[model samples]
Target: MIASTPRVTATHPSLPAVFLLGICALLNLYSPQPILPALAHWGGVTVGSAGLTISATTLGVALTAPLAGSLSDRLGRKRLIVWAITLMVACTLCCVLSTSFHQLLLWRFLQGLTIPFVFAVTLAYISEESSAGSRALVNSVYVAGTAFGGFLGRFVAGTTLEVVANWRYTFVALAVVELVVLCGTLFLLKKEANFTPSRSLLAGISGAWRHLGDMRLLLSFGVGFLLLFQQVGSFTYASIALLHAPYNLPPPAVGAVFLVFLLPVITTPLAGRINAARGPLFTYLLFSTAGAAGLAITLFGNVWCVLVGMALSCISIFAGQSASTGFISSHCQHDRSSAIGLYLSGYYLGGAAGAIVPARLYAHFGWPGCVVLLVALAAVSCVFACIAWRK
Candidate 1:
């Protein structure tokens, strides 16, 4: 059985830094999403091919997440996060220099390689540092920050591309925001007070391997995979669909549609309280069902209906993410960073497939087909939650 760790006093003041950590890590991940159509036009490729940009990055994240977790287990948390942020900023700047689609994918993949260092490490840090009572709240805040960052990145990229008519400038804008976030991280993020590094890198790897057999961890990893698969698939294709349809929204307006994310910014933090009150299994099942319903509403073909559906879907995703991460934080006793790394590897591997599979579905059967596939995935995720987390 896993032993529970004693909670430290929650550091309320550090919440802002934690929030910023979420933003900095995610600001670049999906920034290219809104401009996929524009990229296809510029690169003389199909939308599916252009989406390889997102796939490349997610693929990189999946491959590196476990290694990053192990490194954090051997290195210290804040040190790894700071170094990763610096490297991520450099990679974003390099994206601005890409003259070809393949070159852009290469830089994007490199950027993904650095993100798990910040994402997985901070999650482990929060799990270690916060008291059990406040852990859910802290995780919720971080998830909210990520939701906002995802919105901001898409908004800024789409609007900038619309205004400048140049996609490269969007990368420049993203790089600038990342620089500001880097400075805040350096100034505000606290050093780990509860970390106990592994005796060696090999030991850390061994711990990660053992996590694969833990049912709780494995189930959480499955939940994570389905969550991102639904999220990335829905939004990436929806953005492309809006570009050519009865809606005929411009890139800026589509970017504005991402304002749906702001709703989560306000609502996701409540997930902590909800998980605490209702339990993570209850929270996950409730939201997963709601997400499927929301996707069904999108088939109505009205723009307002689509926006409303998307909003519900987005909110469900953030809440489910909080619940899943909270489960890992509470259930896993040893090498929490490695556990989170494995979770992220599955999560982002789903993200990579989400980017590719939905585009192909859209190509052959259209938006309704994408919706059907995503809703089915949500249903499967709900079933897994029921089986894995049942009392």
Candidate 2:
């Protein structure tokens, strides 16, 4: 048998690092999903309050990711990663230990602080270390893996909660997964300790400011926000709408919706190729417009509409997300981590912002309002795509 050598592009540390990032992502998002019904019952909360678990994490990510990313850029990606993981461990433990709604909210908010390091610095590291030819390929792997990890996290949360009577076990299981990933990360990731740590918080803050002021970065930020806004706003409320009235899907059926939503992410590598060749604008529109159309089907109030919406939004979210990260990496000349921080900060921020809006819309106009909001945002996103395409 002839022996073949491994391709260099196939060998970057990002492959493993992304797996680690996936664990962190799983730790970050998995809890609220399966536990939402329990949380509502436990806390006597409205649908909106039940949803704040998602919003709190997004808010935490939005507000603190820049700081975490800037710190990593200053200190070293590995060091910051270790710190973020440590804090994440503490937060995850707290999640398992918490006794009250307020307590879970507080811990989840703190947990959000860790996402930027995994999201931004990981991207920065991949951008820094990967060869030009394989940068996008590595990105696709990392992003797609992270997406899969999210599914795994949801699986852990859903199954553990179902199998074990205690919700604490769900959080405990997430913490255990994180611990394993941490150990793997320590071994598999290339140590960037030789890199100079950014010492000044003020400098990081200033660098973020400077990056934000750049029109390119701002445009990138807008793209990031719109991508997530349309995604979260539509999906969150659509699930609620489906659970109401005639469709009346079981909770498990609702959960299965997310399962199917993840299906298109298998094409993340292709989306990366599309981004690299046609540019982010074309790819963003292609995905976002499809998502918008799918969301529009909600006007008809049919299960098929929900399914179509899920398909479009998932494809748009996955494709737009990877493309936005690539665009931010290419456009910013300054602290790459800092720029990525800002990008993801906006990304999560959109989740936070959209969470509040759709609830109010649904209150007034029912399903129609949610559709109007998504369609409007899609239209605006189209404008951004057009501008970016011209560049």
Q: Model 1 lDDT vs. the true structure?
A: 0.86
lDDT (Cα, tens digit) per residue for candidate 2, span 1-391 = 2124333354765477665675476456645777788777877787558778877777788887778667766676777777788788889899877888888889888888787777788787776665567766677767776667777778888888889867778878888888877887787887652244455867776787788678767877887888777777877787787788878998788877777546654877788777777877787778777777777765776888778767777777777777778777766656778888888878777866776678988988877788888889888867875776467
Q: Model 1 clash tally?
A: 0
Once model 1 is optimally superposed onto the true structure by TM-score, how far is the C-alpha of residue 299 displaced, in angstroms? 2.7
Measured on C-alpha atoms, candidate 2 has an lDDT of 0.74
CA lDDT, candidate 1, residue 214: 88
Best by lDDT: 1
Model 1: per-residue Cα lDDT over 1-391, one tens digit each: 2235545444666788888888876788878877889899988899878978877887788889999999999997999998998999899999888889889889999999998998899999899888878888899888888898988888889889989999999999998888877888788876777788888999999999999998867877988998998998898788778888878998767767778888878888887788888888888888778888888898898888889899999999999998888888778777889999999999988877787778778999889999999999998888778777766
lDDT of each: 0.86, 0.74
